[model samples]
Target chain A: MNVYLMIAVCSAVTLVPRILPLFVRTLDSLPKTIRKCMLLLPIAALGCLIFPLSLTDFSSSWYAGLVGVVAAFLSSYFRRPMIISIIISLVLTTLMLVLFP
Target chain B: MNVRRKSKAFQVLFAVAGECEFDENLIYSIAKHSHFWKNLHGKGIVLMQESTLCAKDGMKDGFPIFLGYFTTALAFGLLTRTSGLTLVQGVLISLTNYAGSGQFLMMNLYNAGSFLFEIALSVFFINSRYIFMSASLYPHLIDKKSVVKRILIGFGVTDENFAVSSLKGKMLPFPYMMGLIFTAYSGWVSGTFIGFVAGNFLPPVVQKASVITVYAMFASLLGGEVRRNAKALLVLLVSGLSNSVFILLVGIPTGFSFLLSMLLATAFACFIYTDEEVFGV
Candidate 1:
């Protein structure tokens, strides 16, 4: 694949979904079931992104990442803001890598 | 009780502020004694402050997300470089396609010499989630932004932006959204540039550790989401477990597997939560 053409193609594809909603009519009148199901998209999308994809680099420094996960969950569970949760997890991830290495 | 009236008061405050060209301290003093002040909650006050104090709040709000995106974007840039892409190409990818997973998958396909059609198909499916995100956010545009402005704003709606915007219950001002997007966009592009320029300087351990940021972010988001609702927890499990199955046993591509799992989990959630009997955990 020609690199520039591939990048353009990929970029266009991603933008299509995002830009489409601006042109389409509002979704307020959609079926109740569909709207309710749509609410789950963010959760499901987050879940889909989390598990197997996150499990990829585990064999090498899985413990470090795992430690980060625990810290992140605790931070969020305590109702901390997104930034605080991320900072806590990053710090924990770094600490785990150092301590375990 | 009346959310629309309160929101309208918010728009009027900002509009008058803009017309009069009020200073920050003046607006702050007025906001303290404003009638809407008594009726509105803490969120409304913050939205009022956003008209003048946006930069400060935006920076504060955008910083943590910036940190997360910066590290992952740096890793992405490094990946692009190693994949034989030029620094310019890597940066272009970040600028044009801010979707992190989609960009990663694109490079993977490129490296594998996958057919162009395959690349296009995977990219479309990977990013199809954005349609839902954008549609969900449309109702929150207070001013009924024009198509041109909507297109511009739509271009910047990544997962992180959607999360941030969705949580804010009011219509997002263009400037406020711009402030948020500005910080994130700069962090992402700069991080990518730095990664491309200094790929070899970072220790392998640090690079490896940075990969955890994505997982940590998602986990944290899920934690916040499920802390109150059992149904959300069920959806999370269904999506995560099903994704694992699809990837491990069924041998589906990561992008396709993720999209499929999302569909299955969302459909199941619709069924499970229909009656709202088990609404609360």
Candidate 2:
């Protein structure tokens, strides 16, 4: 497959959904239940984003990604500022890999 | 966490940024300069009316997201390089597709030597969730006169900007939204560039460790959501479980598994949680 053509194809497909909603103003007309479901999509999507993927993110280290997840889970539990928790996770995960490896 | 004042010219900051850094002197100076100072001097408190959140302000609002995206994209750049893409192609992906997960899926497919059609199909399904986000955001961009601005804003809408604006629960100006998106977009692109170019100087060990950085972001975000909303736990469980099952046992593609997990969780959440419980603003 042509790499540039593949990039174009992927970019084109990606734009369709992101840009399609701009032209359509259907939120107000939707049913209450449907609206609620639509609104809930982010959380559901977030859930899918984290699991299985996080575990598989590390190509070389098996538990490095898990360590990052755990660091994030523990540090963010107190409702800390967004960056603080992430930095903590990054530092800890990096340290784990560097030391253990 | 709301504070009400009975006196005139009383103002309260929501402290959504987790800092209640309201200085009386600063407020007075800003109020003295703003036109709303006169309208609000002897009237009741109105938060949005007093300050015009311009593009500059939006950039300020988006600073956190910018910082996060920079680090996350750095990791992405490193990962892409290791995944056998050149710096230019990695940058190309970041440039054209601002959506994170979709780009990751694209790289994965491309690396796996998947056909263009398959890559396009998977990316389409993975990114389709943005439809709901953009549709939900339609209510806020209700200004009819600025169709061009609306289109631009819609193109730039990411999860962070959308969350920040929606948390305000008001119609935001076009400049502010653009500012937020531009700041975040710059961070993402620049980070990728630096990570690919400068990241080449990073020790191989550090490069290997960087893959966990993006996951760290998602974990923290989900943690924050769980802290705020009670039912986020259930959403997390069902969606995560279903996605794991679909991908692991059923052997579906990651993109399709993601979509199914999202729908199942959304349906489950709607049936169980009330409107107020599900909607956090």
Candidate 3:
């Protein structure tokens, strides 16, 4: 596929679901069971994302990912703000790369 | 004349007194009848109110959260460029191919000279989960709105936005969700552009290192969900085991391996946990 066309098409396709609610009038009226399932989708997707990472060969990237995971978990466990958790994880990951290198 | 003036002053005082009494009584009545005050006494109401407030706050707070997503897009762009994609191609990938996993997988497959069918299947499998995500979010959407708006908003429902919006425990207003989506969309596209442009300047090692950002963000998101639903613990275990076994034994394509693992995990969860009330349709 032409890269530009491919990107545009894929971006449009992805955006479709993301922006669906803008046209709808009532999001809360959907079936309860459906909403329940939707709640689990993120976790499922997240699993897919990290699964590949874990399998990759050991490298600075893997180590950085480990640090980030720990930092994110700790911050989240303590109920720190999302932004804080992300910042801490990123900073920790970056530092691990610098220090270990 | 003096009597008339005194009567007028008395009338003005009485009017002031009447207004004060009316205001006080109105306040008392509202305190007794308003849902806000009533909710203070009801556990369910209090929980609902709190969740509503949280959702509202989350919508407002979505901007900063999306910055991480932007970084992930940047990393993806960097990877894509190194994989032989042009700068424009990288930008298009970020904009059109908004799916983080699918795009990454496609890039990897492209490098391997995978067959068209293989690539298509991988994309379908990775994106299949969205069918479920969309189904779940469908009810929370404003179904009565214009089709154009619905389609537009639906496009932005990535894992990040979906998770944040779902936690709000209420259907977010369309405008608010738009704000969140647009902010994230901009971040992703811009990040990709920057990453592609900068990819040439960075060493191969540095470019490779950047890939970890996506993994880190994914870990955080996964960890958050796992903490909430112990069921996810089972899913993670099953997925990890299944992927490893498939890789070792079957030697299926990488994308297919992931798809099979996810399906196996979901099926296992469905069968093992028969309590429909807990697992849902």
Candidate 4:
């Protein structure tokens, strides 16, 4: 695909969902359960985003990625900022890779 | 791990770029100086109002997020260059799409030689959460914005902007939202450009190490969410385990596995976890 076309298509698909609601004011009229589901969508969607794909794919060293995951989990769970948590994990992972490789 | 399965770009992009927002001090200053300020002042005693047009505050809100976006977007550019895309394409993706996960998916799919329809479908599904976010935020927006202004704001409604505005808990002013989005947008695009130019200059070892950023971002993002909402831990485990099983054991296609796992996890969360339990204190 032409890169421009790809970007355009992706932009359109993303913008449609975001912009459509601005025009449609009846969203409040949606059923209660549906609204609740919408509220919960983030957790579920985020769950699907990280697993099996990011946490497990350690081609060079699984141990490196595992340590990174643990570090990330601990830092984030302690409510550290997102960037700090990520940096901690990266540092740990890099150390492991350097040591093990 | 299969090289195809090692699509860290999409997963990392989605994880960190998902929930972000910043303060609106800079925009308030601009709006205060603009002709729009005259209209804002004409309506009432601007000083007495809870939300003054001269609200030259909250500038620090997005600074932290800006740093995060800069690093991730930089990583994104480096990854794109490594993935065989030119600098222009990487920058264009950030500038136009403004959706990190979608851009990553597009590049990953393009590299994998997937057809346009398949790429579109995967992106659509991955970003489907935006529809819900928009709907949930609909009630919180001010009623006075014109259609054009609303459309513009809507385009700027990334996960970060939405999360920040929702936390503030009021009708978001157009200028404020614009300021927040524009800051983030600039950070992302500029970071990508810098990464592209400097990507090759990095040592080979540093370049190899940069790939771990995606997984680190993912784990950190998930950790934050799970901490806030403990049930989200269950949701994460369920979806992650299911997706792994479906993709690894059952040999389901990546796209299908992701959608199925997401759908199942969302449905389960909806049925089992109440809003108070999951989102409430």
Candidate 5:
């Protein structure tokens, strides 16, 4: 694929959904079920992004990703700041790689 | 006060200050305490300060989001190099498509030799979630009547800013949304640039480990959701587990699998989730 054309196509696709609501009519009249279901999209997509994909992110050791995820979850559960959670995850992932390799 | 009185009061305040020992602060305080100033404020002329203050508040609330996007975009920058995309291409991708997972999936599918249509299809599906966010925020616009401004402000919606914006019970001023989105976007683009360039200097161990930062952000966001609604835990699990199944066992591609998994979880939510619980009404 020509990279520029591909980027254009991808960019246009992403931009439409976000900008569409402004042009269209109000969304308040949508069916309750559909609206309620839509509320689940961000949470569901976050889950889908993390599990299988995060599991495979590390090439050196699967355990690295696993450890990083655990650290991230633990910090996040405690309601520590977001940057703190990322740092904790990054540190642990790096530690795992250093020690195990 | 009417506009005439208001202007007269400002002139008197300035005149008094000019005649005095130049106590600008005293003149400002006098003008603020004047009945004319209070009357103008009462007539809804206090918007300029409040709007600027709201933008400042948005920036404060957006700081964490800025941090999250920075680290994640660093990872994205790292991935862009591995994906054989130029620095400009990577930056353009970040600028145009700020959706985190959708951007990653775009490059991944591209690297996998998927056609432009395939990339677009999957990206559209993954990013389609933003439509609902935009919809949810539409009613909160400070100036919703203008289609041109609506379209302009609509572009500022993102997952993080949406979360923040949705939490506000008041009307969302354009300046506030712009402040929030601007902070986060700068973090993303700058992080991508640094990550792409730093790839040459960073150790391999650290480079490999940075990928988890993006995942860590997603986890933190999910954590926020679960904290808000405990039942969201079920949706997260169902969506995540189903995604794994679809990709590993069923051999579905990432884009479709993600949407399918999301659908299954939303279906589950429909059965158990309450209107009050979901909408927090």
Candidate 6:
């Protein structure tokens, strides 16, 4: 396959759903049950995204990630802004990398 | 002309007009004191609304979770160049864009001359879940007025956008979706370009090391979620068990293992908590 062509086709195909809502008229009404089901999508996606990270064997990288996750949860629970939680987690992870190395 | 009668009539007219004016002022005063007016005066109200809406859309749909994806894309670009792809090829892949899984699969499938059918099947299988995801989000779309609009927006549906858009429901306006997608798309493309550039300037080890940043960010987000909902404990347990079984007993590829784990976990959760109230339904 021509890599460029493949990339183009793939990108085009992938972007379809992402950009579709921009033009569609929002549904004026939906059944209450369907609306309720929509809420589970995020939790499912998040679970998939995060589950792999914890299992990755990046040496001390896993520990660093663990620390970052703990810190983020605590900060978020305390009502700290996400940006603050993110920065603190990153800084802490980087420090762990340096200290352990 | 009876002067006394005329004076009495003028006095009655004045009294009626005064009463009407007083009632109008009283109604206006009550309206001004209402909660609707008070909310409008608060400085942070608009900002708070926008932020909450953005958070719901961006965070839920993985698209706005750009920082990790950006770092990973950059790493992929650098890796691709080392693996024999040209700089143009690397940039095009990220720019034209698909999710990381499909792209990674494509990279693995790339050879001197690969068959079209093989590649197509791989892409289809990897992306099949998106069909369900888009369907789930169909009801929440703000622009479902026409077939053309549906087809167009349907094209952008990925795990990230679907996740984000579904959670947002009606709260996510079209402009916000545009903003979220634009940011994510740009981040992926630019990150790839930077990765390609960095590939030329930096050592291989340094380029590889940058990947840890993506992992760090993912950990932060996932960790937070797990802590918040005790139910997530079941997800974690089911996922871990299935993954171990698939990897150890079945000896499947990591990608397949991860996918299987997700399916099993979701299925188990659905069965075990059938009576549990689903939030967005």
Which lDDT tens digits does candidate 1 get at residues B136-231? 666555445577778777887876666555445445666667676677778888888987887668676655565666567677667766675557
**Predicted candidate 2 versus true structure: per-residue lDDT over B38-139, tens digit per residue:** 234326453433336688977987776677677667767876887777888889988888877677667655654556666777677656556656665664
- What docking grade applies to model 3? acceptable
lDDT for every model? 0.64, 0.65, 0.54, 0.62, 0.68, 0.49
- Which candidate ranks first by lDDT, i.e. highest? 5
* Tens digits of per-residue lDDT for model 4, A10-83: 88887887888777756424665765565455457555555565544555467776787778778877767556
Model 5 lDDT tens row, B102-199: 88778766654656666787677667656766765665567677776676667667665665554443457877877777877888889889879878
DockQ for each numbered candidate: 0.46, 0.49, 0.33, 0.47, 0.48, 0.31
Residues B212-240, model 6: lDDT tens digits: 33333334344444554557557656766
In model 3, where do residues sit more than 4 Å from their true spots?
A1-42, A45-54, A57-101, B1-62, B65-68, B99-145, B159-180, B200-203, B271-281
Lowest summed lDDT across 10 adjacent residues in model 1 chain B is found at B20-29
Which digits, one per residue and each the tens of the lDDT, describe model 1 over residues A40-99? Answer: 555566666667665555566667777887787778767675446666877787778888
Off by over 4 Å in 2: A1-14, A56-61, A98-101, B1-65, B100-148, B160-180
lDDT of each residue in B1-281, candidate 4, tens digit only: 12321242223223334333111111111211221222343474332124432122223444444665787787678778866788888898888788866776566556545566767776776666566566556654554368887787788777665655544423466666666667767788898899788888977655666555655656666676666567767888788789779877898766666667877888887887864553332
Q: All candidates: CA RMSD in angstroms? A: 9.6, 8.0, 15.1, 10.0, 12.3, 17.5
Instruction: Rank candidates by TM-score, best first.
Output: 4, 5, 2, 1, 3, 6
DockQ of 5: 0.48
Candidate 4 Cα outliers beyond 4 Å, as residue runs = A55-57, B1-51, B54-65, B100-119, B132-146, B165-173, B279-281
Clashing pairs in model 1, backbone N/Cα/C closer than 3 A = none
TM-score of each: 0.63, 0.70, 0.59, 0.75, 0.73, 0.51
